[model samples]
Each structure stands twice: as C-alpha cells, then as structure tokens.
Target: MLLKSIRYSLDELIYLLNQLSDKGYSKSCESLGNETIGEHTRHIIEMFQCLENSYDLGILNYGNRERNDQIETEIEFAKQCVVEIRTGLKSENKILYLEHVIGGLAIRIQSSYYRELLYNLENCIHHQTLIKVAVLKFQNIAVIENSGIADSTSEYRN
Candidate 1:
C-alpha cells in the first residue's frame, strides 16, 4: 500500500513538474512564500542528495542540514534530484532505515527506503497547492474545468 502511494505521489509530482515548467517567474509577489514550487523542488532535491550522501557514508543517524533559505530554480534542480534519487535507490543499502529527530518531532523512518521518494512527491504536492493558489491570486487567473477562458461569461469562476 505504501509503495502504491509512493508511486502515485511520484506521478503527481511529475505532473506538477510539467505544470511548473511552463510557468514564468513573472508572477509577482510581495514576498516569496516559504514553499514555492521552485523552492519545494529544490528542497526535494536537497533532501534526496542528503539521503544519498548518508547512504554513501554509511551514516545511519543523520541530521537536517538546511543551509539555504530556498532554491529558486525548479527545472534544473528537479533533474539533479531525480538522478540522485534513482542512483540511491539502485544502490544496495539494507540499513537505509534509521530513527532521527527533526523539527523536534520523532518520526518513524521506514526501512523500505522508499519513503524518501514518496516524501519527495508528497512535499511537491504540498508546495504545488500553494503555488496554484498563489498563481490564482497573483495573476487573478480564473480556473475553469471544461470550459476555459472561452466561457468568459462567468465571474472568474468565483
């Protein structure tokens, strides 16, 4: 079940990648949000890279080492992260599971080692929602399901 969820999330993340690829940085905002699509993608990359480094170092216990405010480029960052994630998954690491405290929370780290991949996807979704909302607000763009702007008879779809 978890694996399925992971795959689904991964697919969703891929879809988000497509959505974000065509988005321009012209979207104006007073301040960059904590988790924009680009930042979220970068965070996933960073998280995967950290996991890969820990796997390589055989370090069972690890810590969060966030050294930057946020990553602004999503496409290139996602590409790098996807490569690292694939490499890490292909490697033979039985002890990929470990318990560590993060944000003062003791979360159970699963051994299947697939959680990282899924988390990446889930995190992307978490940020994409924010991005979508921001896009709506920033551009004042209306979202219509079947009939798009062609049906301009609606009041911005509320």
Candidate 2:
C-alpha cells in the first residue's frame, strides 16, 4: 500500500509536467529569485534518485544528490528519470542507514527503504505545490484537481 502511494504521487508529478509547455517549464519566477519550475522538479526527482542510487550501498546520503542539469532543462528527460525511479522503488524493502552531516558532525541513523520512499513522496508533493504556483502564475494553466496536494489535504476538502 505504501509503495503504491509513492508510485501514484510520482505519476501525478509526471502528468503535471507533461501539461507544461516548454516556455512554462523553463520560465523563472522572480518571486523565487528567478528559479525555474524545472529546477524544482529536478530537485524533487534527484531526491528519489539519490535513494535509488544508494539503496545497494545500504547508506543513504541526501547531500550526494546528482543535481542533473539535463533534468532541469528537458521535461522528457525528467519523465524518464521518474520511470527509472519508479522501477527502483518497487524493490523489496530493506534496512538502510541514513547519514546526515550537521555542524561538522556526521550522524548515522538506522532507516528502511519504505520510510525513505514515503519521504520522497511527501517531498515531491511539496515541490509540486511550488510548480503548480508557477504554472498558474506564468503559464495561466490550471493544474489537475489536487495534482500536487497530499491525500489528507484532498480528503479534507471533500
């Protein structure tokens, strides 16, 4: 059930990205210090990518994100990355270690792949909210109802 929810959130993002025009996808928002929607999308996708890439290593470090620029410039490329991530997320759950560096100190915490997948799902929804704002303000496009909203929020609305 959890994995299915994560996949659904990712698919929702892909649907929203497909609706964006090239100009809309690449346009920077002055309110966001001229950061493009594509950049936000790239960041979100990279989070998932980081998890997938480090799954085999048993150590997850979010600071090691790929930050691929191609994903920021090309909608199709981002979509492909999503497909790869979805496939990676389907693997059996396993225990993993999360490494975080704070104030010059390294902290290691035990975690599971399922938990990280949930984190990525929530992270994508938050970023998609920003992307939805850009789509509305710059492109005047209406996002599919509840496309980027969390299920709890959507349920409250109904």
- lDDT winner among the candidates? 2
> Candidate 1: minimum summed lDDT over ten consecutive residues — where?
143-152
Tell me model 2's lDDT, rounded to 2 decimals: 0.85
TM-score of each predicted structure versus truth: 0.49, 0.91
In model 2, where do residues sit more than 4 Å from their true spots? Answer: 138-142
Q: List model 1 lDDT by residue over 45-113, tens digit each.
A: 566566656664444343564534334554645655555555445334345665587898866555534
Model 2: per-residue lDDT, tens digit, 1-158? 88888888788888888788766677788755799988999999999989988889999999989888889888999899989888777568999899999999999999999899888888988998888777777544557788779988988988
lDDT of each: 0.49, 0.85
lDDT of 2 at 96: 89
The candidate that achieves the highest TM-score relative to the unseen native structure: 2
* Clashing pairs in model 1, backbone N/Cα/C closer than 3 A: none
